[model samples]
Target: MSETQKLETQISDMRREKNARPFTLAIASGKGGTGKTTLATALAEAAGMGVTLRDCDVEEPNAHLFVQPHWSRHTEQNRPVPRIDAQRCSACGKCAELCQFNAIAVAGGRAMVFAELCHSCQGCRRICPEGAISDENMPMGSLDCGMQLKDPAAPINFISGKLAIGQVMAPPLIRAVKNVGAAEPLNILDCPPGTSCPMITAVRGSDFVILVTEPTPFGLNDLELAVETVRQLGLPFGVIINRADSGDSRVHDYCRTRGINIALEIPWKRSIAEAYSRGDSLCEKGAPAKPALPQLSATWPTTVSVPTAMLMPPICT
Candidate 1:
């Protein structure tokens, strides 16, 4: 057998032996630039426990910019992509006809397959009577996991994945990272921006979701979409208003009216941003916000409910 085949077998065996622990927390936002990563890393560090960080934002992963991890293992995340055998293909367009994703198309008496478009559903292979469709493992991305022993006195483990450029599917890589770090070590999943498939996959299995947002009009709009996404997934989540004082109070009002809890409000502060840009944990700097970290952590399990009405009047954008 080829080396790839051997590697595949080993990975399969490893997954079969894997048993994931619960209590995954997903940090997500309706959009980017909301300091989601900053809050995620801070919460993880301030939790001050053995936690595994999974940066699921494959499109533009930047968590490594802050919480650096010592190298442990980097493994390729691959998925089965269909390959058509020219000799066996009958040009009957059976494969193309069966593919719901439209990944396969026939023209000029031959069929072509688009790997990126394929969702690996295997419908084409199953429907093809000619047995012309074969599946091959295609490289998707890479997952890096390591221990964050930044201070010899303090130790933490982190796992992150970088999706290959042009790779549209990020859920697979996210799952790969999670699988590798499934020791149930207080997982903090820093999900990708947006309320789409990638975000859904990242937070689907989490125990709770921390929806990070700002106080601007755009922030409120995106926060609603994000809340809807998490609610549709039936996951309990709360809001963390980053840049709390930068914009209108619409986010607070909306959260209150919708019966969503505003778990934490990170005020708009230049020092906080500067510290983040410089790769320093706000909790480590003895920043004023540092003291509130413990309170935020303690509220996770008990404060699961949101208010049904707003006491303060809503502010116009």
Candidate 2:
């Protein structure tokens, strides 16, 4: 079989694995406004039963806006922040020296932990020789879980992570969101934009990554960086060009030269853009429905089947 066919077969096998870890697919973009969330929510809605949609864009999660999950459970998420016991500290600056993020600093016999800078790695606690460092859970964010609030019978479990205002740590919260809902057969992670730590954290365990981008120069530029990021992580990925009909073919050229597969292309349409502006999913009835999105589902393993109505035909691809 060709490499593409081989990859599809491998992904199919993963999806069919009984009682194993869920087959994860992360939808990401190199820059904002590339429609990553739109595509993600569409797939999640189309996948129907036995699927979990995780909006891992903790900093500014918007997938919830589209899925409208009626949150049955809300939980506050906290990360460990080092609390130094001054009485036990010798002012030797061990914690400061050991901390890579500069989260801890020692001076004048006082060690202060910068809660926002801490990555919750707990390295300071492990490195403290005098047992001066203790861990305190610092409120970082919140997670909400529920089924489709608008339609309880939609058969989708939605989980979203929202970083508390003024909280700089996002990877921790994203990881927390991912930790839940592993038992589901299929998972769709809507990762944060850009190839940063938060994005990497969300995309880490995904079986496949769908990189969404536009045909514009800005889109092509960031897409290259995103492609590099995913490639370095040694993950299988494909590109989805939004507004495919409007811009030049630089993105296409780049992908062709790199031997990258363009999985699907969503054309630019006034009706589609307007529907998206009103927060409508392409899989929904209100969106400019056309034919079934075979180009996308074709990339899926044969074992996995999305309903024809759910996989609405709105775009050329």
Candidate 3:
């Protein structure tokens, strides 16, 4: 087995033998407008057991709209951007050469670093012979966590990573968001759309993934890409066909052919759209989607390979 697969196998063994952490689920979509956030919020509301709904869509987080969490804890997330001291150094171009992101350059007899381009690897600082490079804090985003509902039986903890208005360093901010005290028994990660770095970061440590998609050609096309992404990471995942009736039966056919599980099918309705527009969650008391949530949470995990530690990055500061 490959390294990732071997890690996955060990994780499964640990989960079964050591009873490590509770199951974590990430709701993601191939493309936007696939009802991913909608399902994620509903699942968190209904999963109970003090589940945390982490909105990992740092770039444009909308889970907060549906979660309607009462804010209690908030903190800024920062990344290190280089500060080049021109006075201390000859333009030897060492920092530029060491920067893996090409964020630094020595041009026109001066050294320059692009704040946005820097990955904060600190390699430039480490490699600088003249000690001319230093790190400065750059705000990438913020983290917020609180309760979703007042009821004790199903009180939900909500956490979100909100990226700065124009910043692109979503991965680091996402890493910061994961630093919260997510002691809840269950957690649902509402991942960003697509299979990019941000989305991967959001879903990294999830035990199982719910790939939400519409029933259109566009949805299927992107869903294939997302499937490849998750499979590449050796993550076990299934599909959810949102607006199942809007498009043809291609999605179902595709899943069946691939032996992929279809966990839930949410047919589109005008009322559902209306509730969403009003910032109301699907599993609200009188909402139409309330009755099926428990089943939704229970159905997919029947065939899971447990893990010891989740697919997490290095612990954040």
* TM-score on alpha carbons, each prediction: 0.83, 0.87, 0.84
Q: What lDDT tens digits, residue by residue, belong to model 2 across residues 1-317?
A: 99988867765564455236566788998988899898988887776557789999999999988888778899998899999888999888888998889988887778988888899999989988899888899999999998884444547798999999999899999998998754677788999998989989999967778899999999999999999998899877788899888889999999899877787788888988888888888877857533334567565432122322122222223
Model 2: lDDT to the true structure: 0.81
Give the winner by lDDT. Answer: 2
In candidate 3, the residue pairs with backbone N, CA or C atoms under 3 Å apart (3 or more residues apart, or in different chains) clash, namely 11-307, 11-308, 205-311
Total backbone clashes of candidate 2, pairs 3 or more residues apart or in separate chains: 3
List the lowest-lDDT window of 10 residues for candidate 1. Answer: 308-317
Q: Write the per-residue lDDT of candidate 1 for residues 1-317, one digit (tens) a residue.
A: 99988867765554444323435678999988887898888866765555677888887888887888887788888977789888988889988888878899999887899999887777888888889888888888898887777655446678888989888877777777767764644678899889887888888877678899999988988989998998899887878888888889888889888877777778788878778778887676666567656656445444473221111111110
**TM-score: the better of candidates 1 and 3:** 3
Residue pairs with backbone atoms closer than 3 Å in model 1 (clashes): 259-306
lDDT tens digits, residue span 1-317, model 3: 89999977877676564334656778898889899899988777666565788888888888888877899999888898889888997889988888888898899877988899987778888989999988899988888888876557778888898988889878888777665765665678888898888889888877678899988999999999999999988888878888888989888888889888787788778878888899887776687766655555455454343331233211110
- Whole-model Cα lDDT per candidate? 0.76, 0.81, 0.79
How many steric clashes between backbone atoms does each model show?
Answer: 1, 3, 3
Model 1 C-alpha RMSD vs. true structure (Å) is: 11.3
CA lDDT, candidate 2, residue 155:
72
